[model samples]
Target chain A: MTRARALLIVPLAVFVGIVVLLYSGFGLGRADLHPSALIDKPFPDFELPTLAGEPPRRSRDDLVGEVRLVNVWATWCPTCAAEHDELARITGETGIGIVGVNYKDDPNAARAWLAERGDPYLFHIIDARGDLGVDLGVYGAPETFIVDAAGVIRFKQVGAVTADTWRDSMAPVVASLQAAAP
Target chain B: MTGRTVLGITALCIAATLASAASLVDAYDFDNPALEARYRTLIAELRCPKCLNVNIAGSDAPIASDLRRAVRRMLEEGRSDQEILAHLQDRYGDFILYNPPLSPATVLLWATPAILVLVGLLVLRRLGSRRDAVELTEDERARLDALGAEDP
Candidate 1:
């Protein structure tokens, strides 16, 4: 091909390449959504009220010494409800610690919701003001973060942690994190 | 009748806007005008992590609300603008910053438009040059005329 013809193909090729790249970019974005800004960092310090009575508070300090999932959920969120059984199963099968953040939810409503459908969390923390949610960079309800033994946030699952998500992403990360825990 | 209904709806919308505007008033008091200016700029520049490409100031998402409060608290505590921006950016990733810093990750983002312009100019220049096609050889012209004569 002549130099001019070859040069003409370059822009066309770049345009096509960009189109393909954008298509994949959108696909990946939809899959991950808002990846929580707190991955690979220490879990944000928060002293939130517990969902259950008596203890009244749960903090990041309560999550150290083992790999655990810090799940953000609310009574208002249907996705959290959808993922509840999966979370229960993870807790039941793996016996791993899952700390639930009852994000911006009514205390009474949150208590009732968990009571109605078995509370899977080791300890459910109340984020009634959503202060912890913002500090944790929580996009929305049903986000799960895997914090290692030292309180460092290792991985973040942006959406509902379904059986598929647990099997595919969180399980593998959990395995490594568990191994890495001191 | 339709016009009256439209006017009523417009009035209702204006009322709702005013009510929400009143609700959005910040609770924090700035130490100085410079601090207030910095706070405003920071909120405007920071993306609401929970909203669809909206700044924290405009977004009503719970995260946005809390972020606004956090910014105010930081400003009140005498944290520098850079410190507050870095703190939020570190937690929310570079996506939090509306005007992202020029860095390795954003080199393509900053360069794509410029590259496209250069490519466009190259194409235009090539096209302009091509318009002045090379002169056909006398022998070639004679052959073309002969072929035309036979075809006719």
Candidate 2:
């Protein structure tokens, strides 16, 4: 038809097309929140039997009042196998105690994992039943949590821990925690 | 349509119908609402690595169903949300998350959408402005003048 009519028609068609796409779930809009966005929140709670029947080494109480690195790991997880050495170096050399959560792994394998790599943790908690791991929002092994002295979670790393990442992202988090404490 | 075409369409419809039942049947018993809700959240966040398209929550694969049950058990036993997620993340990589955390590998996935949207808007604005600024052709203007004269 006329030029003015064509112009009005094209924009109206574009608007209607956009509305249809949005209704059909094809919108270009972004949803920033996802399930993994729960990091830096309070750690979930659980009390589990410690490895080797050595008594319950960690609980909600242990997470409170310190800047601790809680590493969730299992012997079966391949990434955990890969990151074990880096974890040992960071915890051993840097004097940052990595609290190990032996998640859903066989007790014997758990012991062997520590024996082969040498235990870098101050204490290791057995999550053979996976109860504690679930409490801490652990989806898999080698997940790390940075908990402040006040029990507020500062950071939650969803993958294997590396020396570079610990130095870069986690060290600052630790410093922030120390500053906030007392 | 041919007979073969009709049969194929029917088969496709049957498969589509079966998919929902297969997924629901896989979910294990959780009498408690709290435990079931936690299990749902856990499964939705977990990717069915084998399936690739569906989350563990929506997948009918036996392994995904088993993982769903295991998640429920963890919740019933009093594991926290973080602990449950950590358990899965430990078994799977960050790939389990539909949206992985902002890491070196994942930064591109997170950032690309916003950047692309901004670029798209800029392109649309330029195109719209160009369309708006164009003058009518001589023939179109003459036709418009005749139409305007006729209107009065």
Candidate 3:
């Protein structure tokens, strides 16, 4: 190629690269949809009190042997409340188990919120101090994780799981995981 | 006002300011200076997972405070710096650290500056070679000599 043509190629390649990069970055629908590092890894070990404040506290051992959605939520987060009904509907329709993590919330307030809003989870782990939330890399409430039968995390959905979210993003993953389960 | 009274008021203000500043720093008591220094350094290096761009030491978020406490606790437990960082990384991934570890995913991020420099040097060399490749025609050389001679 001529020197001018060679020089032109460099800038053209750079422009094309930058355009592709920018377009891909913008194509990502949500800014909060960060990729979780714990995907495909076993759930973090924790033996925390149940939200019911009963005996037989739950731990990582309880997560195995089932395909479930481990949802991180709190009474203080309004988005969690907003998604509560949708979550219950999802469980009702899909027959998929949901385990709740009551992160960094007052136990009384959390219990009241669940009772008022209607509890969707099979059981709730009280992460009152957020220690278990930290262990699970939960930065905010309304985050959901799909854990396979082996207790391996398959996918993480940040923010509230509305009906649309379940239909589009989460339901497919859950279906696939359930199909794959023994 | 009398000079003594004025000095006493100024001293009081200074003392008050110092006390307030001290209160701003987290009061985690360390058994030794080395442990305290390590705690400070670790918090400074660790990014606040909840915030946009602030390190744990600089952020006031609840998560940042919790991370700060965790770092101090680990340091007291006799964990090495790498161990502490790895502990956070295992949960939060490499995003928790301001300086990410070199891996297949981050190779491009770490290599971009050097790649830019290499490209710049190559361009510079090409330009230099092009300048050298240019040979003035005999007539042009004579004209250039004549212009130089006229300057004298």
For all predictions, the C-alpha RMSD in Å is 7.6, 10.5, 6.2
Can you write out model 1's per-residue Cα lDDT over B1-152, one digit (the tens) per residue? 69999999999999999889657646567769998888888889999876759998777777788899989888999999999998888777888889888988789999999998998899899888987886889999999899999984
User: TM-scores for all candidates?
Assistant: 0.77, 0.55, 0.76
Model 3, position A5: C-alpha lDDT score = 79
Q: How many clashing residue pairs, candidate 2?
A: 32
Per-prediction TM-score of chain B?
A: 0.67, 0.72, 0.73
Question: Counting only residues 3 or more apart in sequence or on different chains, how many pairs clash (N, Cα, C under 3 Å) in candidate 1?
Answer: 0
lDDT of 1 at A41: 83
Per-prediction share of native contacts kept:
0.56, 0.00, 0.47
Quality class of the docking in candidate 1, CAPRI style: acceptable
Q: Rank the candidates by TM-score, best first.
A: 1, 3, 2
Q: Cα deviation in Å at residue A23, candidate 1?
A: 6.1
Clashing pairs counted in every model: 0, 32, 0
lDDT of each prediction vs. the true structure? Answer: 0.83, 0.73, 0.85
| Candidate 1 local lDDT, residue A23 | 86
lDDT of each residue in B24-139, candidate 2, tens digit only? 54646778887777777777788864465689877766546556766776788899988877766754557667767789878888898999899899989988998999899999
Query: What DockQ class does candidate 2 belong to?
Result: incorrect
